[model samples]
Target: MSVYQVLERWGIKNYRVIDKKAIEEITLGASILATGGGGDPEIGLLWTLGTLARGKDVVLIHPEDIPDEVVGASVGCLGAPIVLTEKPPSQNVLEKAFKQLSSYLNKDLEVVIPFECGGVNSTVAYAIAGELGIPVVDVDGMNRAFPELHQTSWVANGSHASPAVSVDDRGNMTIIDTKEDNIRAETIARSAAMAYGGISWKASYPLTGKEIKEKSILYSQSIAWEIGKAVKKARESHRDPIEEVMKKLKETREVDSFRVFNGKIVDIDRDFGGEATKGFSSGRIRMEGIGKYKNQIAEIDFQNEWLRLKVDGETLCLPPDLIAILDNETGEPIRTDIMKYGYRGSILLIPAQERMRTKRGLEIFGPSYFGYEEEYVPVEKIVSKKGCQK
Candidate 1:
């Protein structure tokens, strides 16, 4: 069915038709919410922009509007963000991955879903939809950014990311469906990325429209658009954008908003640098936390996404939640690549949604996954006890 018919069926009249300008704004907002973990937006944006320039229309459709029998999947780049920054993706990487996977399954896909609502992944899904003349679902696996492959509602509800296809800029491809485990799928994909010069193209979670409606986080694109709009408004009025974000998200918790040091990065410690860590990008960050927080210290450890936050040995935040270090002046988020010891930025902490706190969710992305012996503590509680949350 046509995308218009689907939208009509769902009674969703507020959906935004993504033109070039809207795409830019959405990508910027996604990068900020990514909390220093989603792959570079420039690559994803440029790819989508190029497709539009070629006269292709990238249409977004509500999940419920889709036909129950239509097959759908998500397409994006996976591997280290650092690697993606250094090596650009080939123009046809996602298409190649999709084609190979479909050929392997002897099935044709009718729609595309964004795996996460971040810069690269979000726009990449739309680009694929545009290229293939398929409708792009307005939902995703994770409403927010996450690190691991299986750290999504799809996996939490028992759906698999298997039968995934990975491709490289050089046109080399690898399909991994033999391993049913999500971590093992990630491991194999990571190794393929290493072999393909650190970044690998991927198409995963092949499912039907009915399965997507049941398992996916619907209307996530609308959420990102609303968050982006609120931030921009706050900036124009000289209001606190973070506060505005919290208010819009209905998040009542408060956390310390640390000040930026000197606005320049001085050092970064990337763990597992020699590939012994099995495709994981582990690292620690130390910043001066200057300005109002000047002379204070801010230390953060990350395994994919920011895992822990501390200031002079006092715990500020932990995993299964979100912590972001952003530019104090522009309110732009500072990623790991741009993060330095002398870099000046504000630190913001937010709690993870309840969807990510279920028993299965915790077991997949809890503190234990990161080698921490302590039990998982919700960010709200930690901040509340410290009086950060009022």
Candidate 2:
């Protein structure tokens, strides 16, 4: 079939092709925006590139352009990132999930909306788009990645992840339909993942094009690509990638970002153990401050995404905000699943998208939601209180 025929059949008037080079840039930026969570970038990159190599065209469309009746679902890997590496997925993981969900929903799915811009989910969504011969929506649930399934704009805005289907490589299948209780859905899904040996693929948060627009975060794909492009351009010019990230924020959103600390990873207490830590990686990182913030200690916490940042014992950033640990010079993200001891990186913090700071969002993804016994504070306010540039 011709490309024109494909577009006409899908009623897509505006879209962009996901070429090889574009995927690379998108992967880089997505990983950085993942905020220390989102699993491994390499795994996602290889899968996406493989899809492209097979002569399948992955197309992306604007959310607004999608007709109200088109069927959409949020799809991606669901498990511990560290565990996923140990148990690599079979080619049919997501496809099987799609089939199961389609059977359950009794609708032919057309588009896959990403849950967030992450090292893994972003590309996996595109790979599924290619496999299913559908266009991937450019919008997402969380602008940045979060730990739990319910930590998304979709659920916060009255969408439910229930009627969710999870499938594993071992052929395990479980359907979740908690009926307006998305947290219960997440708990059940995470349990299914752990029981299936730590990595499973899922399809859920089923919505129409109209529900997606009402529930999901907006313009996430382009934002991630732009962030990645800025970092790549800076690298080619032999400039600091951190500054390039700041430049993009200023140019695009007028949002200020900051270099919270420059340091070498001295210790990371990544909680690796029994039921408490199963299906999720949670812990604290201690970085020995260097360069301008020399002779001081900087610390941060994580549960998928970086939750907090403290500089010399002062709380500098909080959840809903983002803390990205990047290779200070190369501008590459250092992920939670792969960071090594003694790795040198700069901790950069970006404010959460305005949509994520809404009352429901803050209540669900805020510090209190993460078990932090403190009021939610914006990164800008926290930075200014510390006498840092806003």
Candidate 3:
């Protein structure tokens, strides 16, 4: 049977035989879901596209198909994005990381799991899955992108990223076994990245299908894919892409997302001193709201991902949730590195996933974790108070 027939037999209606076009769509959607972080999707896109060019079949499997005993590894690159761009990565790094992880765990992974639904991590899972001749699981730790490793549902739901392996371009490697402390694993993995010239590929979060089913933000990959396809379809048809986004969020995620503002970026106060000094890009953005929001000002703070959003001095969203800046017409994500003065976009908001709304998740990645003195108020509540839809 042909691949199409096989896909049909597997009931893979939601699954796409990841090709060049599919990669582009997935990257576009994942980047928007990345919440203004996850690095440039181009980096991840290039890697996946290269793999596809080699005639590899990168198949995305639904999370429900993952068996109870089958194990998976969280595949990702950890470090500052600026550094990653400068240092680049070796094609062999992921393979080495996976080997080291498997050898340490004394078991091979049946599949790969994305740590988060960012552009890179989302594609990285597919990239590794294809390279390993395995399938990529649809589940992910974060439904939206987050900055640190520990902010994911794996940690929020009491799992860890440890017993991990970090590999550099030069074939050098470090095996980190934090004995279940995900935060310490992040610190150690981060320092390793800095030491290895600021970018390291890692295979961590070894989990059984059962554990992942219990802890992960199940079906996040499919959510990102559906959201992306909606935007793509809308754009191709010349419809309102933002409306497509809202519709996708409600239909696929069963969650309400809000378009809080539309505006032009007026200023970006980035931490310019931190190209090498800091491991992550930290900054604030200012935008002049347009149209009906004329004369209104909007602000957002970030450390990799959008952490806080405020309009005219009122907070509309905070950490552990999501804030994406998308092009008003095309629905493409406008990342921090790419956002420029005078760029027009709409600010979209999504509530944190239920798995990410737990008490521990809040303690680890809530607004306070980003240094906000105020507790997180649900975006729905905030929008409703403004008399918006639920």
Return the top candidate by TM-score: 2
lDDT of each: 0.74, 0.85, 0.82
Give the TM-score ranking, best first.
Answer: 2, 3, 1
lDDT of 3 by residue, 197-305 (tens): 7778899999998888899988888788888889999999999898898898899878888887889999999863254544777789999989977999999998877
Pairs of residues clashing in candidate 1: 260-345, 261-344, 263-344, 264-342, 264-343, 265-340, 266-341, 266-342, 267-341
lDDT minimum window of 10 residues, candidate 2: 1-10
| All candidates: TM-score | 0.89, 0.96, 0.93
Per-residue lDDT value at 49 in model 3:
84
Kindly give the number of clashing pairs for every candidate: 9, 0, 0
How far residue 30's Cα lies from its native spot in candidate 2, in Å, is 0.4
Candidate 3 TM-score to native: 0.93
What's the lDDT for residue 357 in model 2? 88
- For 173-232, candidate 2 gives per-residue lDDT tens digits of 999889999889989999998888877789988889899888777778888889899999
Error of 3 at 91 (Å): 1.0
After superposition, which runs of candidate 3 have C-alpha atoms over 4 Å from their true positions?
1-16, 272-277
User: Which one wins by lDDT: 2 or 3?
Assistant: 2
In the order shown, the candidates' Cα RMSDs to the true structure are: 3.2, 1.5, 2.9
